[model samples]
Target: MKKNQSIYLFVVLLSGIVFTACNKLIGIGAPKNQLVTESVFKDTISIEAAVLGMYSKLANYNPGTDVGTATSLFNGLSADEGYYFPGTFYDDFKNNALTPTLYYIDGYWSNLYNVVYTANSIMEGAGAAALPEGYKNRVMAEAKFVRAVCYFYLVNEYGEVPLVLTTSVSESNVQPRDNVGKVYDQIEKDLTEAQAMLPSDLRYYGGNRTRATTWAAGALLARVYLFRGKWSQAGAAASTVIGNPGLFSMQPDAAKVFLANSQEGIMQFVNAIPSSWMATNLGASAAAVTPNFVLSDSLYAAFETGDARKANWVGIKVYGGKNYPYPAKYRYINGVGAVEHAQLLRMAEQYLIRAEARTQLGQFTDAAADLDVVRKRAGLGNTTANDKPTLIAAIEHECRTEFFCEWGHRWLDLKRWPGIANPAVTRADEVLGKEKGTLWQSTDMLYPVPQPARNVNVNLTQNAGYTN
Candidate 1:
């Protein structure tokens, strides 16, 4: 048989396996069947298809269970950014009383691992294939970038997690949880390698912001470094992206930032369907109807009086003689008028990351300069903060107002920042305790490791607050 014919046969068999195994392996099984053999990677088209499939899964815009949507929704609720009014299972998150048995928790855990397993599969197949070295490098780099993103969220949400880097079911099924520091080490390694291999041209994705590039890797690395408290590295990484003005620049108009292929978007997910899940859920389709998910009073109040983001990114619906403010970042609820894409990384965030890193390093003047860039875009004046302590507080406030109800940035920030009055406690502890009254607990900082995941793998352990 010719090599091409044999490869075609393998593709046919793999398609069958994918459909049959997706359901069985979706949750704790990690979609082991989606792992393609090396023969499937022999051709460039097949290799591209494999990588595109991973993006499709990550970009799944379904309202429930998808990792991207769940991350924004549940985490928004878990923090003080929003409220869920239907009295559904999501209320647990709003109350900071998540359980291992919670439906969305299990869905989130399963979907995230699904992405990880797909990335591992791509790396293994690409490594073994007889493709050109450059092509193979690009494929492997993209896979590593995807895996790093999933692990970033996993470590943040679940604390210790099984660092499953291979597609072998036997290896993954019984893997034990690795510590937070170890997981972060792997994430940094993956991103560093990806940054070196990815194309620097923004148009490498054919003038679309959907795919990963050198800028995407650098932007994410800046965020990862900031979270890890590596001040200089974070600042440097962010500066690399900010310096590339031709490829990326902040949208002067806050309302235009979420539009498809906006100049501000470092990386985004082009909607698979015409509509966006964020818009459908957070935006009111009709004037009389209220969105079930509304922004919290505290978040609405966080915006300064003259901030452009408050005027442009928030939509208020008056129904039954009451006002409900919801996220207007994505305005196309049904995809009828203007197009919107799910923004994963943007230039504004890079400026904020650099500002925070600069503040922590005691470069107050430079940090304030970065902060003012975002402030000026929001139609606000330059920051009054001149010293390290005040600059840090100012940067934190900007992050809250700029990123609220977008991707759980507020939730993550609250957990990471020191309390205003007491440095000993996290801002989450101090803030949520006051916001949620008696409902908040310190252990709620990390969500429970989903019970179904624990059921399938005996080696998996529960987090501090949750019982079996």
Candidate 2:
């Protein structure tokens, strides 16, 4: 990655040392002059520069920027998705000794909110910028979409969190954790507005698929609704994106979905530089023979004997006279030529979301059809799940295989299933019991609020299980 260039571009957006615990204690905020100064807002080019700065911050594959990197690795180790062979970086997650002081966990919390701060800066400044009407509206919409996505991951990971919507110094440091339901309400509001303002087609800047569009916003809304149990809304959103064949389609080959500019990419993190951490850390390549993570026995055994995904998505190697299977979805481990881009939001997930939503709404037969789209693509025949109860189980199985090791999809699925009301039969409770011989506690679902955040703001309470 062009670390120096990216850091220089985003330094203005950062305003202060990242939203760090130390910074908050010192009462530091972006100085008024450093924010979108009147001179900067008066020019359209400068305004665009500021917004692109937020994109640069996200695309940087540093400690906390790439959610699919360290964050997903830790989550997969904690769940049944995979096994980490690296150092004690993963021990806290794997062995359930997670404390608030874990550096990576703390970095994830602060880095995400740093992105949130940039988004809020744009939202606060764009309204007064002297730009063309169309340009101003599009910039505002993109910022809102970015902010909503950040909060989506935060709420899912840390149940209740501080909802920082403004860029004010005092408000940023003093805000108390909002209820999870309340946080989702704000996410819904932002995405709904973004859907109307962004363009219907895929957006491009300098010939790269980095900007958000209305379709991207819709696909994400579908996922958010699915998580929140809004069945009809989720189904409708997914169906709308599915209908847009010009903008999206399922890649007939499951192996090609992670390739750059693939047809199935609804939204992706365009890699302008060579930094495919997914491949380097998870696969065996000439650049590195021993990968950091290996596929879990349970995950490998779950595949059907002739499943195409098993053949195409995993690579087997012998190290120290033991077989190690690693994720091969990302083929460019060396990151030379930047052949692979990070797959964040894609079309396949929309189908699974719709299938689950339709099942909840009692549209059993239609739900089966949506499941078949993904199933057939994976070299499997139509499912035989004829009833709602049976079909829900079938859909869950498809998600586990389709999205394993890509993001934290499997871990999040285990948390969302069985719903909050049915804690006794939670999927984690059952699966963890068999895999690790231990019972899953309810609080294990959420990561503890990082101690640094709590140290800065006394009102922030840690999640149920951990001590600050």
Candidate 2 residue-wise lDDT, 1-468, digit = tens: 685566456555443323232223212233333354465455665567667766655655353335556556767777887777655557677765678988877767766776787777777677877778888898899999998988998898889988888777666666788999999999999999999998887544543456788888999899999999999999999999899858679988877877787888887776643236676666657556576788889898888777778888888877789988877877674445337777778888999999999899999999999999998889999999988778978987898788888768888888788833355677776676567665356578798888877776777887898766
Off by over 4 Å in 2: 1-36, 61-65, 203-208, 272-275, 419-423
User: What is the TM-score of candidate 1?
Assistant: 0.93
lDDT of 1 by residue, 1-468 (tens): 686575555445554454334333323655535544765677787877677767767767235556666777888899998886544647788888888998778878877887787788789888998889998999899999999999999999999999988776667778899999999999999999999999888655678988889889999999999999999999999999999859889999888888889999998987634236676555556543777678988888999989999999888887789998987777675545478888889999999999999888889999999999999999999999999779878988999899977777989999999988999999999889999999999999999988887887888989887877
TM-score of 2: 0.91
Q: List candidate 1 segments past 4 Å from native.
A: 1-34, 61-63, 272-275
lDDT for every model? Answer: 0.82, 0.75
Task: Give the clashing pairs for model 1.
Answer: none
Candidate 1 local Cα displacement, residue 284, angstroms = 2.0
lDDT for model 1: 0.82
